[model samples]
Target: MIANFSQYGIKKLFLPITSVVLLVFGSCKDKAQEKPTEAMVEEVGTADGFESIFDGSTLNNWDGDPTYWRVENGSLIGEITPETLLDANTFIIWQGGEPSDFELKLEFRISENGNSGINYRSELLDTIPFALRGYQADIDGKHRYTGQNYEERKRTTLAYRGEKAEISTQENASEPESLRNNVQRNAWQSRKVLESLGHMDSLKTKINNDWNEAHLVVKGNTMQHFINGILMSEVIDNDSVNRNASGKLGMQVHVGPPMKVEYRNISLKQ
Candidate 1:
């Protein structure tokens, strides 16, 4: 009787153990046989009431020189080699739509010689493909020109960094003025100079060589530039001769040395 009871106990334990093993193996086998799920494509979404301009995977609504522009790692990349040096500055014009009273934001990184800008309320030049002629939030790898309000192919240098000036076309009105770079506050020490004026520094320190946030707010004739949450420059464009009310948006790759610039997370609200 004891032997019978022992045999029954062994059978009971073995059956349960075998059942568990079979169940686990069956589950694993079923999972393996199931088709692998396809990866979901990322859906680009708007941010802070701003609509996305670049899908990050394709240049669906951007127009530029294909040799220098591409989408890589989710950034709009513009690169040029010494052999592909351009004779004039070019742009990747945004085709999604033009903006008037709007705010534009994006992230950018440029090589040491890279010169680029965010052009808004700009018109395309018939002389050059993808050329813009209007307001540009100027940027340079040297941090000398970054965060300045420039008018491309128009009244150049509307306002410089660390400056709060009003520009008007009226002969009696105050013309474009700037706090010219000084020895102690030269391009290398731009941040210090701006800090002295309680403005966002244009020093390379505020910009990560890898990536930095650039924000442009344009409402009517007043435009503002900010970098990494710091106000770098502002322009009250009362220049009746050159100020634009509305036009296309673009990204520029200035003609000079061989350089590269990457931009992503571009969004605009109108």
Candidate 2:
């Protein structure tokens, strides 16, 4: 009788131990089968109203010259290879709606000599294919022009890095196209620098060739550019005549030597 009872007790313990082992193995197997996801992608459905514009793996709703744009390793890349040099600036424009009052955020990394910019409140240039004329959040490899508010092919430089300025309408307004692309097109606009956000060199320390976050907050006549949470530049676009209230959004691969720029985590809050 004693031996029989001992055997029953051992059996009962073994069953529970075996069941626990099976459950452990099954849990691990299930987890291993699950695919990995990027943290940014996972946050797409979060409570925040910000929604991702880029799907990380595809450019389904984007328009650009395929020759210079592509997706690799979950990034939107634009490369101007030595063999595929460009004569004029090109862009990968977002096919989504032209957000008028919105906040834009993204992560970007550029090659040492790379020159790129984010165009907002912009319109497609009829004169040049893949070109834009509107407000730009300027970016470059050296951080020289990074965080600046430039009106590409339009009013020119609205505010430099570390500047808070107001762009007002000019009576005799018309900044004609010049031989140089960066030439000031303030013909019918006047910029009054309100104050210095900070020193250029001091603010530049917040940027690098590595991935960095850029934030653009444009509501009504006010536009703000932030690099890594620092207010780099701000512009009050009072130039109602030339200001673009709403238009397309695009990323630029400026005309220059061979260079590369990668963008990811593109989210917009309208």
Candidate 1 structure lDDT: 0.78
Clashes of each: 0, 2
Q: Where is the poorest 10-residue window by lDDT in model 1?
A: 182-191
Among residues 3 or more apart in sequence or in different chains, the pairs in candidate 2 whose N, CA or C atoms overlap within 3 Å are 173-188, 174-188
Per-residue alpha-carbon lDDT of candidate 1 for residues 28-72, written as tens digits (9 for 90 to 100): 989887854443222233235788889999999889999889999
lDDT values of the candidates? Answer: 0.78, 0.87
Best model per TM-score? 2
What would the per-residue lDDT of candidate 2 be over residues 51-124, giving only the tens digit for each residue? 89999999999999999999999999999998999889999999989999999999999998999999999999
| lDDT for 84 (candidate 1) | 88
Segments in model 1 whose C-alpha atoms lie over 4 Å from true places: 1-47, 171-204
Q: Residue 234's C-alpha lDDT in candidate 1? A: 77
